[model samples]
Target: MPTTQQAIPFHLAFPVHSLAAARSFYGELLGCPEGRSSADWVDFDFYGHQIVAHLAPEEAGHRQTSAVDGDAVPVRHFGAVLPMAQWQSLADKLRQADTRFIIEPHIRFKGEVGEQATMFFLDPSGNAVEFKAFADIGAMFAK
Candidate 1:
């Protein structure tokens, strides 16, 4: 049985145009450590989760979006919830790197339930990725 104190790890597999680009984006830029790899796919330790990038150009990138909080949020995306400071640091790092943001780092739902600092950006293959943080973690899932 799983313990409440420890969240279970998750595995995600997504398509990428090129394995080299995935390595550079996920491994070098995002700092996700590389794991098992083969000619067609590569895995990264994405913040304690397993994320595999398979070589499939036609299946990559996010096309549709949904309106949310006055922003066009990608319809299909995945991300992690970091602590406040860590989120800030990553935001700063991405800024310094001149990464193009889908949604620039900002606090949403201010003074309301589930208020959080969040950002959205794309990987080299145009996969939308989001990173967010909550000042009060308990508010994360609150309505």
Candidate 2:
């Protein structure tokens, strides 16, 4: 049997079109608690990780997508792997905020490997995030 690994927190920086809108989306809509901030950038505790929104118009315009299970999955996306309950809570919270989703939160691969609750949404800066969770941790990377 393999030992359970400890999940280390991380920090990520991504481009956004508007700092103010990004602030509201992450800090208010998504409910990520606020951290540090400046006129050009803002930080949030994104599911236990530090995610900074930087004002970069050039990077915000382009989006890359790929075909996955007949769905056009955003190629340039980042997200946290949360516990099932936490993931459900986030989905509920987003719905309550009237947040629009690129992909509705749903279970993928029912009764199969890598089955998870997944959803995609763009930040105010246009950066994409796909939050997901596996019911069985051991099957997180199953093929």
Candidate 3:
């Protein structure tokens, strides 16, 4: 018999203009817990995945767009998929905080096979992050 392998968390490291800003955005705002850190970088438990913010001012933010669903989606970005309720709550919280959005929260591909609630915003360092939720997670990869 073949054995099934367990899923493992992913690790991502990206540049940030300032560690303090990164902490405030990913930690205080997004609520990701702080992990190990050094003078040049910090790690965060980003919704069960590990993401590191490394201080590299020159490499912080770059903008590129690709059209999708009639939206100019950011070409360089990172994000997570959350449960619907959690995603909604977070969207509300961000709105209450007066956070500027690259793309406002909305449902895309309405009534389609892969419809989902999604929002996009840039952190203080100008790095784009997207959060999305699906009504049916089983349809995540549906065709």
Candidate 4:
């Protein structure tokens, strides 16, 4: 729907220990809504992308974290930069759902370059997703 140039909406698969827990985390907690679900795998609409949670307990703890803005960000994370209005709506929805956040939603660089609302949270499968929004799209690449 005329997303950004780099936003064609891709598909991804991640490992999950429990399907039911993953479903609750993505479907209920994050409110991703459901797509296709099975005993070993489940598909979810992750911010307009297709994400499948495959049952793979062994791959659960194999992720590494990298330093980012003084936080240990997951090395294999994915998310999107939603519009400001959508960001606020999602923030309220997350609050209503009592979503546990890895990084609380807030402005990172207030009154500076790249100022935006950012938040990090993990699904039941331990996959990290960071949602960010830029009030001024031009500031996305400011220095």
Listed in order, each prediction's TM-score against the native is 0.96, 0.88, 0.95, 0.80
Prediction 3 TM-score vs. true: 0.95
The sequence of per-residue lDDT tens digits that candidate 1 reaches over residues 1-143 is: 87545799999999999999999999999999999999999999999999999999999999999997888999999999999999999999999999999899999888889999999999999999999999999887677
Clash count, one per candidate: 0, 2, 0, 0
Which candidate achieves the best lDDT against the true structure? 1
Clashes of 3: 0
Stretches of model 3 off by over 4 angstroms after superposition: 1-6
Native-to-model Cα distance after best TM-score fit, residue 16 in candidate 3, in Å: 0.4
Two-way TM-score contest, 1 vs 2, winner? 1
What RMSD does each model have against the real structure? 1.5, 2.6, 2.5, 3.0
Flag clash pairs in model 4: none
- Per-residue lDDT tens digits for candidate 3, residues 22-106, read 9999999999999999999999999999999999999987479999898889999999989999999999999999999989999
- Please provide, for model 4 over 14-62, each residue's C-alpha lDDT reduced to its tens digit, 9 standing for 90 to 100: 8989999988888887778889988899999988999998999888633
Across residues 60-96, which tens digit of lDDT does each residue of candidate 2 receive? 8327899866568899999888899989999998898
Candidate 4 overall lDDT versus native: 0.83
TM-score for candidate 4 = 0.80
Which residue runs does candidate 4 get wrong by more than 4 Å? 1-7, 141-143
